[model samples]
Target: MSTALPSAVLGAAAHQARITLVRKYTSAAGVSTVVVSLAVLVLLWFVRDVQLGAAQVGAGGYIFSGFLAFGVIAAAVLGVAGELQAEREDGTLLRAKAVPHGMTGHLVAKLLAAPVDALVPVLPALVGAALLLPDSMPQDVASWVLLVLVFGLGVLTMLPWGAVLGSVFRTMIGLAWAMMSMYALAALSGVFYPVGGWPAPLQWVAQLSPLYWIGVAVRSVLLPEGAAAAEIGGEFRLELALVVLLAWAVAGLFIAPVLLRRMARRQSGSAVQAARERVLAKGY
Candidate 1:
């Protein structure tokens, strides 16, 4: 039966235009976009290193990977959600509804494009942090390559869930709450520090969110062998990390399409107009 192959193919074909648009957008983003973000990530890494001078870069390797995880989560959760919400309110989704296989195209392009969005800040930040670390970072090309691959996997692992949130919570208020919940999980997820320091209860709670596993996976690749002592149960838990991330990826793979389809089916010009009016009445 011809279920998604044709639609997915058409979507892939249509996405070239969207890719060009995203490229144009990145070009327009220019210096300030990168300069500002790199500065902040670098500064954070610097401060974190200074604060934890006991370890090299205060375990800069772990922190660096954690920072990478944070960027992925932020981009997927905040960036993707905000963009989707804006598209919905501004009738972008409605326009997609009018086009043949447009939604598929959009989703495919997103799977292709959203990581670039996540990486815009992430790549620079990672490089900057590594530069600041005078100690031996992941020096081997394989390790570096693995780090990149891990981040890409991280993006797929989380972006769909982000889209689901964007679809479910169309309002800024709802999205804000969802984001707050994410942050809460991250606060205890050992993204900035070690999980060995967290309370048992909080540690368990953090484990439930994807952020913790993401940090674990990234840290596994970037940090040295002994770094596992700083991790929960004094282990990298790479297997668990992969299982969890893969689980999320699978879940999102299935769930996002259904949610997006439902959202699309519900879209109408009147609904978009109402969203616009609501935003206007709510003020800028």
Candidate 2:
């Protein structure tokens, strides 16, 4: 009554499952990315020529910097955390643990998958903004490189923490708190406006979060030199931005593995079934 599949076949199937999981999440996240990117671009289109700030900053360019930060947050935090929670609840995580090297492949795929899925929403907003308002975006090779560097680092900085969120919060209600935390960061991070304009205490609070520095790095690439007047020190502070973001990346690297391993170890069929029951109890 028991016929085990061949080892080679099992390995192949495992690999296929890994790819399928990546594809599944990527497809699901893509539509949202495209829609949000389009919506932002449309917003950019209307205000392509409008200006703000002491430097007479273009609204399109300002939003581009902030939107870049938001796009990364959506993909890296919300998208990745939610999928991990779903997998755990739906028994995919338990099944992955049962297969040899399956959890390894799953983690690797997920680590890479978030950014790939992130590009779905982020790249379009960036590229669209560039194409429509070339004057407002980075025009030189150097600025563009810095732009890419900061954007890449920001995602890398946040993703491990996102995993931590997924691992710690078994329920969707708890996960929703993570999204709210991001919004709270956005409110204080000066993404939508200058942080210095806030109360002195609030300015200090904004600096405590990584999103503020991310916005600064982005503004450096896209905003005019004169725009620095709006900053607390009237400068870009690129070095500080890099240091904070790098610190986050390093911290995450250390934290994600331990948390993920613990989470994987704890996952089981009964736990997943219970999670599903909780979902049903809430009426979906």
**Who wins the lDDT comparison?**
2
Q: Over the stretch 1-284, how does candidate 1's per-residue lDDT look in tens digits? A: 65755855665645664664466456856334566556666565656645343444354555566667888888777777877888888998899889887777776766667777777766676667667764425778897787787788888888888889989987887888988988877877776566876788988887888888888888787776666777789888887888888898998989988998999998999999888898889952
Report the lDDT tens digits of candidate 2 across residue range 1-284: 75554566556655664685566646755355478778899999999989887578888888888888777777677777888888888998899899876766676666666666666667777778878889878888988888778878878988888888888997888888877987887877886666766778988988888778878887877888888888867887888999999998899889988998999999987898788888888943
Candidate 1: the clashing residue pairs are: none
User: TM-score per candidate, in order?
Assistant: 0.87, 0.88
Clashes of 1: 0
Give me the runs in candidate 1 sitting further than 4 Å from their true place.
Answer: 7-32, 41-59, 134-136
Model 2: how far residue 221 lies from native, Å: 1.1
**After superposition, candidate 2 runs with Cα above 4 Å error:** 1-29
